[model samples]
Target: MTDSNMNSHELELLIAAWLDGRLDDEGSHALQNALRTSRAARETFRQYARLDAALHDVADTSAMLDLTKLAAACVRPSSAEQSPTRAQESSDTEGSKTERRQRPFMQQMAKGSRVKPTSRKPIASLRMTPWYAALAVGILLVAFLIRGFSVDEPGTESIADLSPSEKTINTDAFSKVSLSKPPAPVAVLSSVEGVIWADSQLEVGHAFFEGESIRLEQGEARVSVGFGAEIVADAPCSLKFLSSDRIQLHDGEIAVDVAPWAAGFTVVTEEMDVVDLGTTFTVSVEAGEKAETTVLRGVVRVHPTKIEGEPRRGLLVSEGQRMSSDGKGSFVNVPQDQDEVQKQLGRLDFGVTGPYRPVDLSNTGQGLSTGDEDLHWQVVAGPAGVFSEPQYASVCEPERGYLPNDPDVSQWISTADWRTALPNAVYTFRTEFALDGYDLATMQLFGRFLADNGIESVRVNGNPVEVQSWVDNVKYQAFGDLQFRFVNITGGLVSGRNVVEIDVRNGMMRTGHVKDPPLSPIPNPMALRVEWYAFGRQQGIAQADDGVRLWRRIRDSVPPMSMLSYAGPEI
Candidate 1:
């Protein structure tokens, strides 16, 4: 029936048909149109959808009633059934002929059966009594209450709600103690991916209460427990929430970062308990194996939970220490393996600056130059002095003010003019340095490329490095923002006179947005200059007194840019 002609009862019947997957295309189209036009219709549909889900859950859980038998009982005819009419008999005869034509083998097999066959059509229609109808409504109401189902107004759905088709109950929301435990939320899932549970359904931004457990069958999750403590858990793990400050890791690996406020945070493994004393640590527990705890920062106290009659002494593990436990909960201090330690620490940028020397090519009296700011050519440091003398470049361009592109790429020019500089072409910044007895195998080149939406393709002694790894985001102005990368120059380094070439695809003439018209090279001038460039043995680089020590100081880390960055998809 058309939506305009569908009465309230007809709409409800259509909903039931839709729930039962019996609604035809035309009826479904009409229902969708009605939902768009009427708010009440949408609400009613949501209520019925939730009701259907609850009914399925009930059917799966309850053993007292067989749903298939109940369906048969509803359609079964009583002894008062009337005989088939002549027209009905003719229809049945036609249906039998059609079935035979469709499947002759099945018809032949059925014809040989000893048991008498019943017609596909029922002998009589069963009418529902008022009591039966009322009982169904009462059951639906009770189910809705038990499921805590409610119809939300338009545009009120939570951001974390995925889709109704994949709906799984959020056990965290239940207050019924057996199914849902703990009175308050102890943690919140900050982010999650490919995560499904063996025990309960979990979602991002959902508050997790204590006494609840989550099994990470696969995927990863970053959970924030207590004040500032965040736990990044990988797949094949199970975690039981004990309290705001404590949890039991039944299996798998988890990296926990506890702030000062959450100093007493604890993670319980099968072997022992790892108590965080304002630290960042990783606890890995394998089934039937000893639990390993690695302290990334600060300190932790590992205590044996399954000790004998005597009191188990808590072992204080300081920073850079690793403790391995025996299956029976005896933790022994073991030498920390750097490679193994890095794996447990995840994406830490460890300190690497050391045993090498650096030569500054972009300095005064040094070989830094340019032919013409307007010309598109490389200004190599050589004879004839066509390349400009090296001068200090400033990130704070007070005189020139802000160059408009994206607000994030705003920079200052300490010496050169911010505008009317660098033509819309590749500007090669070449620098040469000498090397001696220093170990080139352990050495790496690290520096920033300062240009507005520019800087592409880097080559060392004619060998090309992976631009994706060196350049953080090529589609945007990152190297221009003083962001440095520890470039791996494998086979690019030699004994002396090593040539490092950097190609700059200056985005002076083009608008960052793809939709806008491209500007001509004359009017669109971009400011370009390298703030700093340095190369030496990896050990010669300076180390900062903080976090994971790395070879170079990364200025400003930014996310990667996309190639198909149009206004919308399919454009």
Candidate 2:
């Protein structure tokens, strides 16, 4: 359901149903569309997958048992029917016959086909005698124990005890991994999608016996593997990673920020392998499909290793540079800010200041500008910027203070007379047009409208939420070659009650809940300074365009009303 109040976990569950073959075709396609291009969302999917796998490991140990054999074993031989002379002979053959019977049963069990079909109604099975059931369960447990199915962690439930209905718990808790679930191993099978995660190093590639070790199916994550983490795979489509890393990405687009001492970090993609040269970067790999890597810091060694073990004999990707490989023999060096590259690699087109920073935009603790301050934005600079400019390097600087919209901030700003000087990029303006008569409000919205029109995911509270992409979330016409995603609402801006912030999505989710609603313009969280009229390209410009010519047109042609602006020196 695409309800407005749907949380991240709910949305992730929707995705899980689609991945688990529980949803209808229309729902499945809709879920895919809902998940397209969201790296964090994809990472979330992987987390759900991991969680699902972990719980499954605890619940579905039935395959390990030969239920048909168990059913047969329940029928024991008659002890009274044997004579003393015959008993000795029978006893002699007993052990050997048991082993012989077990041999065929074990073979069938190994093939995963000998397990009797679970009754149509599980309740009937539940109604069976606890002694027999317990024995069957004990057999399953022994089999699992022989299989070494003991979880290193405790109280996480035993796989043998899991009823099929309890499976939803794992899928439900995937997107938002809280402290509720204790530390445990989450494994994914070849058939399972979006159900795994790797928060730390993988000492051996043996972790994934049948399928992917950790599938970054949806959402985003920050993974820091020590030198010990070594990931390797055989089948192509099984392994995946969304772009959640701070530097080198394994599956989806991930940004890696390696500590200076870090070493031996390698991110493999369908196309090529971008090894970490003790640098920070983001690489994205999708669905055993396409892949792209962008280096934000340090360096990445890119070579033509179309196939594993073939020397990665390509070129080096330097800092602030990028490359694209799709596992094909050829790899292309993709330049920075390339729209096609960003779109394909699942990077957003909006201005994302890496990590959320609120104070950089305000100080008085009052709301950023016009509307609610809860809808904060995070921008990651693709390339370096100029002097005194809001460049990537500058934004990455330490003096920027705590993340602006971070949950740590206790005081939320009100929409009264509060203002502060921010970087030009955060507060750029034009006298051309305003949203209704609200110059400041419209100016704040300019950033949002522009950001929403050109990106994949955007943040509306601190958490990164989903929205329609730039192309799909638009209402525009040829207004002198300048295209705009106009929001035709008015009342929201006046009282700052209807303030909205668009989610410029950088990636999509693979599992959990899946939904997409129309991209309606929300009220501006903060206001900007600039006087002008609001203009729509003959395409429903709801607000006024109090005809005034300025150097440039404010972003969305929606300027804040002049009714309530602050006077200099604190109100």
Candidate 3:
């Protein structure tokens, strides 16, 4: 390539990089130099950046527009399409002046709406010179190529599948843009278990941002997006962060709960757009397939994106309704049984293999003894357990699920000093239990923990395993009886003795955030108690035979207290 051609190609690459926020410090400096030296570079940068900003802040109805449509809308029509008459030319000129007049007002409106502004210098004018027209067409064409748009392709073509010639041309043309760097996080990783695959390794405290692609190779993550949306994405899936309120699921399944403040949360797929209607829902998509949207609560709007006709329509999917589309873009709706849907989705299925008997591992040295209160105290008391004594007069009592079927199991242990010291603390309670061999098919482990907002995970034989919250209504009962379930750990178990460690992290106290009750002398301690049951894989667990597990059948039944819990704040 000639020097001028090489410079032009480099400028296009830099402009593309700047538009995607993928430009490094060096590339950014180069981009600035090109903008100063080349008017075409400046125009191209402004055009791409503005279109990107518009798409990023698009409203509910218009969000489904793809990059090609957005680019076409942004670029001015060719000169051949322009008016030939003098009056028409004057009208076009006047329209251009009107657009220039509205530009500042548009910027002000974006600012007032609290949307982040585009990182671009002000455009000189909306006037369309022949040079600008040619530059606009080049910018739009490069935008389509860089954004993964393909022509004369068979079926769906991934970015990785570009032909060598196409790849070489695009690579040299847009070499400045780095597709690997993760964007600044608009959310925090609140809870994570298993393995996550992305361009970068992620941790619980790590932050993620819009436009970042995250894949769950194995495991699960519950990310808190902003303050109001909680996203639970299961592994073996691909997800792209479109914005704080929207994500695109290329594959796998994700469940999202949106608070009222963050209404209109959306999940995008190739075939459809699943928009939240102030509700909780799950969206699933697989390669070469349509997206399945299941509404667990509230409502969702499933809009077809790749329909053949213009003005594509959407259907409302209410709670207990399921909406799905085929690869050919045909959408279907059907009434679904919530329980059956949960089972199919693997929401409530544990996939446990065998039978179980309660095993106790407490500091008091009890081995499944039926009537021991002090031994229970050793498990429930101390620095990491609940407050030694009840701190408040409320209908809430300590979770007695792990206690023996005896009245004396309710003995109070004493408050530890650390109860009031740690605001958001993580406390782990471990139990080393013996197992003869890996003969059992499945093991169901249950444990209790106290926290305002907490999730638990288990390490069996020093390897982290998936643990689900046993209590269904966890959000409503923040301080109520909460338990964690480690279901079907047959794979993690070994032939010899195994150790299970449970880590529970507590949330901030209510006194600081939402004042609802009187202050107590001491805060509740982060307590944990664990029990396990196992059976042979061949025999399979029986639902009616409740004696194998005491708490499984009656999880919702409140403790048969000779005393009603005192009615007040249970802090």
Q: Which candidate wins on TM-score?
A: 3
Clashing pairs in 3: 185-208, 355-534, 355-535, 356-533, 356-534, 384-526, 385-527, 388-414, 394-566, 394-568
lDDT of 3 by residue, 42-117 (tens): 7877888788765543421121112123443455444445322221223334435322222223233335454332
Per-candidate clashes come to: 20, 110, 10
Candidate closer to the true structure by TM-score (higher is better), 2 or 3:
3
TM-score, model 1 to reference: 0.30
Evaluate residue 259 in candidate 1 and report its C-alpha lDDT on the 0 to 100 scale. Answer: 60
lDDT of 2 by residue, 213-255 (tens): 3434333333222121212221222243221121223354445
- In candidate 3, clashing pairs total 10
TM-scores for every predicted model: 0.30, 0.23, 0.31
Ranking by lDDT: 1, 3, 2
Decoy 2 TM-score against native = 0.23
Query: What is the Å distance of residue 154 in model 3 from its true position?
Result: 62
Stretches of model 1 off by over 4 angstroms after superposition: 1-182, 199-201, 339-571
Question: After superposition on all CA atoms, how large is the RMSD of candidate 2?
Answer: 28.7
Deviation in Å, model 3, residue 10 alpha carbon: 31
Would you give me the overall lDDT of model 3? Answer: 0.47
